[model samples]
Target: MEGRNKCAACFRQFNKMEHLVEHMRISYHSVHEPMCGICRKHCRSFESLREHLIGPLPKVDCERIFKDRGCDLCLTIFSSRNALWAHRSTCQFSRPNNAILYRMASLGIQDELRIDSSRGKAVALACKMVGGGSDGSLDLCARVCLVDEYERIIFHAYVKPTLPVTNYRYESTGIRPEFLRDAMPLKQVSRKIQDYLCNGEPIWQIRSRSGRARILVGHGLDHDLKCLELEYPPMLIRDTAKYPPLMKTSKLSNSLKYLTKAYLGYDTQTGIQDPYEDCVGTMRLYTRMRSLAHRTQDYPLATDPQNRNNYASWRQTELERMSPENLLELSRSDYYCWCLDSN
Candidate 1:
């Protein structure tokens, strides 16, 4: 079966191995794609995925096995009957009894203060932009939201733009002139956010892997920071738009809306976009990527930390001569893999 020239993710078979290689080169499939639990085929959405599983004409093999091992709540397939049975106990997502699960979580500020500060934790940030300039073509940060790994709201504020608001983009932002009228000034908002992100770290102590500072996660985070007139250590930030594995094969960034729906199995930004929801979306995405189980590597890029091997021009002939499947196996992500965060 290894010699049959089938894509491991989409399961598309090719007459020639080179065709499969080309498909992989442009498809940009990663662990983030909405995938079939059994067949491992990537689908555009959960709706399509559901259809593929049990719709009018389902995949017979997958449907048969899914009936036995699939957890209907999360649609995950377990390896054995025991595994499925074990999963059932915790698969109560539809009706979570907050009293039992969120007893400590509801403590809010008290719960947050109890967490140890010596270890680094991820938090998500999102900003709502209102239109500025005459035709409302310029973006102005009018509001922002920040949330923790548990999707708990840490900060939510309406920001008074430094520049006068020309258009509120009310249809999307749900903001009005009155909201900004008494809102926190831009400078104050920026200072407060910076302080929260820095934790207790002084300027000199701030580093890429600082536990004192929160690791910032967001989609188009630079734009959000720019609007706030704040700056953070580059190494301390994780921008979903810039993460190599999450980007398009063309190296272009996908919108948060698209990434959320494609990878998260849900729709977003369909109506008025809420900053807290955006924060949760980015947080979910970051944690999902950070949770990748790629084994620890000792070199370059997505490989071992010590190995700096890249496809140098001197190796062009060697690369060309290798079998297509081997070449595909050799190909690695150009940027740091999020799995290294665990290391």
Candidate 2:
């Protein structure tokens, strides 16, 4: 009867240890074959190859895929697959909405749902704002301007700082004296922001009356809201900073300067950012992104298998050329203006 174990190289079954030893001496003697005990990579001799594989040939991790679970968003590494699964189940970073949802919403027009009671005329209008931010107190440079259903400007003002900037580091961002000109004091700014919300047509009331939805537009809107110390529902705000499809495409640079260059074909930030220009850029980017989205259908899929393979091969070649470090540096260079901190 043949033995259960067989030599992988020769595929010869042996019934007895003596027979296997004899076969190794006779048949294997003519050929010099050294095998790594761990991975079976051939080397020179048993002792040398054993030392190379087992002693110190740069330990390569060969763990099974099931053993690894890592969070892709935050790059949180996990030891075991089960542990990774458990961590992902509770990790907000792994969620679908992630960081890019805000940007996607900003590209599309917001629908104002309202019913007209007096004239009984239901009207749907595209309402949006142009806003800007600068380095000041936590709230000094942040402001939102509201536009009506007719695209008429309704109200606008700087948000008041909630905390004093006595301890904050303002010079780090290179705040200029000219940038601070025409700035309202904290008290007055707060009153203005409040009055704009309360006294003037509240956004919800306008939506109700005009049967339209109000869209908040701004650059890096989270920072704007942070400065204002106001929290609007995510759907209400259209943050051009967060728009994803436009950002995913290489046409627009991540910074306002690059975006202005691409959309308006003009280089901005030659001096300080003009609040009005910044606002206009935000609107322009939104319009351009919306137009692009309207022109395209769903993401195109490869119809032919061979074509799909070729496309994937080309993409892999391009990606491999741009290593992780290269990609990170490219991202930093593209978004240095808006990127507050480095990794």
Candidate 3:
């Protein structure tokens, strides 16, 4: 043990070759490897190697588990039996017999609807329609419509603005106050829209009969609905403007002109977007790229409303009735399956 005459590991002395062999076996164990200094875990390879740092070594019982046809959860398919067991403990797919258990397992995942693959689903597109002047006398318009797979505009109308022009801010990017001042009021616009759609029966009735009302569509629709003073269910609204994924990316700009150019290959910067054309374009874009997601595999599409403090109290009450597992399973599948298959 004097000077450099000792073994590099364990610093044990060796008087002869056989003594050193005995020292190595006893101190390091015949099969057991040295424990890593960092994680305090056993390592099979030399510490200097990069593989030793990241790669996990096979456990002694790994082969036996597979040989005995052991639980897939305890096999060597994953890094550790513990990890595999943990995943199996929560995996809905692992339990095919128990519906309740399957549903409960799905609760850990996200809950977002997916698109169907059979027949294409319809997309609804809406947009704010404004035509006014700088003076208080201005007209605000709102358009809500349904579009088809072929990028055809089906139902379209211009609703009147609920509030006066003075109540609206023109300094915003899309607001053209001066033009709005000279335009008609929300009442006038609503009359025009009602006249157009209700001339015979309602277009909504016709579309609903033809099953076109369930189409997938898009727009900066929330503001449009507000301007129109329309109250519809959240499912009826698929506003691309509020979709976080589209907003985070550069594919669609906040401005209609930019969105048209980027998505529909049309430049609306020169003049006002025809309400019908804007609606169609937004729907086309939404239909084209609605499958993309930004989150990881296990990330929930919608957070639990019960845990959110800012949401309405009624939201929690409604959420309490929904089983998280069922929502998660629905989110994992195609969102438009029902629409496409609803013959």
- Indicate which candidate wins on TM-score: 1
How do all the candidates rank in terms of TM-score, highest first? 1, 3, 2
Against the reference, the lDDT scores of all candidates come to 0.69, 0.37, 0.39
Model 3 residue 264 lDDT? 45
The residue-by-residue lDDT of candidate 1 on 1-343, one tens digit each, is: 7655445533443234446445555544443344688877765434456667776678999989888887654567899989999977754322112243223322221112223354347878999999888898899998887778887667777888988888988888777676666777889888877877888456457854476677899999989999999989988899999886567645688888877765675677766667777887888778767875654434524344443344445765575567754664544444565666766
Superposed Cα deviation of residue 141, candidate 3 (Å): 1.4
33-136, model 2: which lDDT tens digit per residue? 33332344433232343234334442344222222443432223466777777866543211112123223222321222223323211111121112233443
Q: List the residue pairs that clash in candidate 2.
A: 103-242, 103-243, 111-213, 112-212, 112-213, 113-212, 114-211
The C-alpha local distance difference test score for the whole of candidate 1 amounts to: 0.69
Q: Put down candidate 3 lDDT per residue, 255-295, tens digits, no spaces.
A: 65555553344454243334445555566556534432223
Error of 2 at 120 (Å): 20
User: Which ranges in model 2 have alpha carbons more than 4 Å from their true place?
Assistant: 1-160, 166-213, 249-253, 292-343
Error of 2 at 24 (Å): 56
Q: RMSD for each model, in Å, please? A: 8.8, 22.8, 22.5
**Looking at candidate 1, what is the lDDT of residue 89?**
71
Locate the minimum summed-lDDT window of 10 residues in model 1. Answer: 105-114
